[model samples]
Target: MDLSSELSEFLRTRRARLKPQDVGLPEFGRHRRVPGLRREELAQLAGVSVAYYTRLEQGNGKNVSMEVLDSIARALRLSDTERAHLTHLAKPTVKKRQRAAAARPQKVRPGLAHLLEAMETVPAFVLGRRGDILAWNRMSRALFGDFDSWEPHERNMARMIFLDPNSRDLYPEWECKAVEVVSVLRLYAGMNPDDQELLSLVGELSVRSEEFRSLWAAHTVTDKGHGSKRVRHPLVGEMTLAYESLKVSGDDPDLMLVTYHAEPGSASADALRLLAQWGVDEPAKPADVPE
Candidate 1:
């Protein structure tokens, strides 16, 4: 993605989302060509000169200061995720060598993998920065279906949300889930605009799914932390699971360890226990005999 163009579009869209009343400005009986706060109005609110703010909005503010950016972010009422995205776009640190190195496959640490395995009853998985399912436990497989069954390239949550038929049926509120998935990816894209894999994934999804295309164009961003999700597993019927997304520390700061749990003594908890039993009872696939 062209950093300048992305920055410009992001600013424009964010600016267009706010109205005069949103920022406590009076509406005069004058004709306005553009929607939301005018450039001069925004500049005034942000305590910046119109000319400087115009240059920043036009993607010419390569040397934009953080204080000014912060002021603009507050003026536009950007969320934490959106503010971070703005900072990334305004001051990108994409070196060709770093971009090339990031293309390598990310692996879950042995300790994390062991920890996941130890939580036999909890549905847990480690996700890479790009939402790829790097590693998952047996409960995770039982809860979300077997990621091992899919090709490596097809193991992305965003891709599954838009492209997989099973995912649509799995989530009760599929549209909302889809939007959240896209929002998380939007955050990743902003931070690493030069990542070829990320760009390719976005491009492929945009071409394949019209829904994805429209949402991507919206430029909405969000941080994926703790949340509750309802899913209808074929084996367990319907269950609402509360999930937590914890960022892995140390070497893999971008990796997230996600785990799901149901309220104690609830039907969802019973369903999860039953699902675990089913997993234990199910026979393993027979190995193929070599000819």
Candidate 2:
């Protein structure tokens, strides 16, 4: 991954989205060469010299202070997540010696799989670096398509959303889901800027899915939090499920424990019960949560 190029593009996209009047500056003429504020205009807003801001935007952020980044972030009207992304991009997180560390696949901690098993009624997953489905419970198999059946390389949420046809049926609002997945993936990419595997995934997705390519160009950054998702199950039909993503305490800080539920007495809740019973009727499958 080219950190400098990523940094430049992220800043450019953010800058292009704004206009002179959008940031309280008066628009003097009807037309301009660029879509958003010019370098001079952004530099003025950031209280910096044109030369310095240009250099920073060109991806030469060495020795750039947090105060300068904060000022530029404010000028761009960036959100908290975007602000963090900017910081990560401007300041490279991984050193040259640490690039080799990216090769190691993240491992889930001991007994985390059991937690997923304990929540039999809810579909749960233990996801590691770059949305890898490191572990999942039997209920998850019932709710989500069988992860156990997929190859390790195929067990990724982002890949499934775009490349897997089953995902189209699962997500009613597939476009929205794709954007969110890409945004989360972008945030991770910004942090682990040199993760070869992640870059490879991005390259493969970009080559295969036009939607993924477009979303990747947008450079959206978002954090995963509690949210509601509506999925259509082949057996039970459409259901709105509430999901919570909790960052678990483990060796891998990025490991997430994601679980889904539905409101009590609602049809969606009943659908979950039926799925659970169906899971029982079928032959018991091994809960292959990685050790």
Candidate 3:
């Protein structure tokens, strides 16, 4: 990917999402040509010259500083994920002679596996940075369908969302979920341009799925943090459950713990109870279950 172009387009797209009134700038008139904040207005907010901001948007700011990047992020009212993305793009790594490397999928941590195994009531899974399903509890396998049975490197959520028709039907709000996947993938691309596995994943999606291609070009970025989602599982019906994504400290960049829970006595909670019943007779062993 072209870092300069990616940086430039991303900044422009973000800036275009804010208006003068949206950022507390007084509304002048409806004669605005662009969609969001003008270059001069954003420059004033970031404490930079209009010409400099223009150059940056045009992909010519090679000596950009972190201070200025933060200022721009502030001016744009960027989220935490967006701020970190700006920092990553501003400091593109110097090219190395070694070929770009794919992330080597790591084994599930023993302690985490034990924890997931114990949490039989809640569906949970461990994910790596690139959206790989490293491990999942039995309930999670039942919740997300049969992904845990797939090999780690092959069980990417983004790929499934785009390529698998079953997944598209399973997610009630599939479009929203698809955008979130692309946004997170965009962040990963900016932060780790040398991840050949990720690049290949992107390439494969772009070639195979038009939805993926379109969203990828939008250049959005986000973190997979806490959120609630609605899923339309064929067996359990529709459910709205809250989920938390916690990063697992490890040598690998792609590692996090995700757990889901529904409010007690709620319909969703009842559905989860039913889902857990499938494994009631099976061994409560971690290794036996994929998710």
Candidate 4:
């Protein structure tokens, strides 16, 4: 892939998403020629010349300083992730290196696995960059209702969400879940551009799921954390749970730890307790928790 073209497209797309009113600019009450602020307008706001801004957007200027980048970022109102992406794109080393490491499927850290064993009351799991269910605690197995019998290739979360009918039944708010999936995937793509596994997963989803394809085209990226999810399980019926997606430090690209919780004394919390009991009482199904 052409890095220069990618950089240009990303900046241009982000710019196109903003309106004059979005940045507190005066609206002339006339038919606008562009959907967002023009190059000249943004340049003026950022204290740069239109020609210089145009050159940077065209990828012709490689020696852009951090001060200019920060100025542009401020003008565009970039979030932390977007700001990082811009810096990554502008850095010479990212373009100089060709050996972008592919993402390895995450393995449950032994300490994390032991921790999971200890947390019998809640469901927790490790998800790799491609959203593969790499490892989970016993209660998580019961909560997700996925038998552990799938081959390595079928273990990805995105695949299960799009291809598995069970996922549709499990998540009551399927559309919201779908958007979350796409948003997280977008985060991964920006963070790990050369991950072959990630690229493969994206290709497969775009081919098989129209919803996935549409969302991918929109180029919406988000940081995933501290979200509420509604899940419908056969054993527990429906429960709304708050989830936290935490990054495990020192891990390579795309590995994370996610856990779900409900308030004590709530119906959802009760359902989770029931799930823990089920995990203890039921026979250990290795097939239910595939390797």
Question: Any runs in candidate 2 off by more than 4 Å, and if so which?
Answer: 95-101, 283-291
Error of 2 at 215 (Å): 1.0
TM-score of each: 0.91, 0.93, 0.89, 0.85
**Could you give me the TM-score of model 4 versus the true structure?**
0.85
Give a tens-digit lDDT track for model 2, residues 187-270. Answer: 989988778899899999999999999999999999988899999999998999999999998566778999999999999999
What value of lDDT does candidate 1 attain over all alpha carbons? 0.86
Better candidate by lDDT, 2 or 3: 2
The candidate, 2 or 3, that scores higher on TM-score is: 2
Residue-by-residue lDDT tens digits, candidate 4, 60-139: 54888899999998998988877877776665354323334443334565666666667777788777666777777777
Candidate 4: the clashing residue pairs are 148-287, 148-288, 148-289, 148-290
Instruction: Provide the lowest-lDDT 10-residue window in model 3.
Output: 94-103
Candidate 1 lDDT trough over 10 residues, lowest sum:
282-291
Candidate 2 residue pairs that clash: none
* Model 1 bad stretches (over 4 Å): 29-32, 95-97, 281-291
Which candidate model has the greater lDDT, 2 or 4?
2
TM-score of model 1 vs. true structure: 0.91
Q: In candidate 3, what are the lDDT values of residues 1-291, reduced to their tens digit?
A: 777888799889998999898888996887988889989999999999999999888877589998998899999999998988877777776355322334443677677898888898888888775787777777887888776466655688897899888887788899999999999889888877777777889999999999999999888899899989998877788899999999887655467888999988999999988888875776543433324
Task: Report the lDDT of model 4 for residue 123.
Answer: 81
Alpha-carbon shift of residue 142 in model 2 (angstroms): 1.5
